[model samples]
Target: MPIKLADIAIFIITLAIIVFYSVTTLQKDSNSSYAKIEIDGNTFIYPLEKDLIKTFHGPIGDTTIEIKNGKISITESDCKNKICIKMGKIDKLGQAVACLPNKLLITIEGESNDEVDILSY
Candidate 1:
């Protein structure tokens, strides 16, 4: 079958969308960054520039996180599947890794600002 006008239009639209998303995702901020760790009801924030290792307790067991070279990763965990540890490292803003069984979440975030967003409400 021959290509139709609609097919070309759709291809162009899809290519444009892919290009737009790629450009936006590649932009990185220069602001200071941190890793926000949350387990149960407690929250902890640590600077990404600092290298450290910390373990937190959850309902199941302990989850250890490590920060090195401005990136963070789940270095150890008691969760059976260990998918969290396999998640590797994250250093970009808004990247996250979670261990659902341990009720743990680690998110990469930038410096806080005075402006409020929808989540703050």
Candidate 2:
């Protein structure tokens, strides 16, 4: 079958729309100033400006997190798959890494703001 001009125009428009939305949804690293660690319902806040290493104890085992040069990463974990550690560093606002097996969650957040955007049932 031969392609028509209408189909080419539609394809270009769709590709442009996808790129625009994806680029607009990205969070800039400059707005990310700190990291929030939530472990077993306990919350710990740390600044990204400083370099430090901390370990949290979870139901499964210990999980080690590191913050250096304005980025945070899961350096070590006792989780079976170690998927969290493999996720690497994140320095953008709203970026997160989760060790589900260890019940640990780390998210890069901006300055003080207390607003719930979404809730799960």
Name the top lDDT candidate: 1
> Which residue pairs in candidate 1 have backbone atoms (N, alpha carbon, C) closer than 3 angstroms, thus clashing?
none
Q: In model 1, which runs have C-alpha deviations exceeding 4 angstroms?
A: 1-29, 112-121
Put down candidate 1 lDDT per residue, 3-117, tens digits, no spaces: 9999999999999999999987776534578889999999999999999999999999999999999999999999999999999999877789999899999987775432322
lDDT of 2 by residue, 1-121 (tens): 8999999999999999999888866744344478999999999999899999999999989999999998999999998999999999987767789999999999877753333213211
RMSD of every prediction: 13.5, 13.1
Q: Model 2: how far is 104 from its true place, Å?
A: 0.5
List runs of model 2 lying over 4 Å from the truth: 1-32, 112-121
Candidate No. with top TM-score: 1
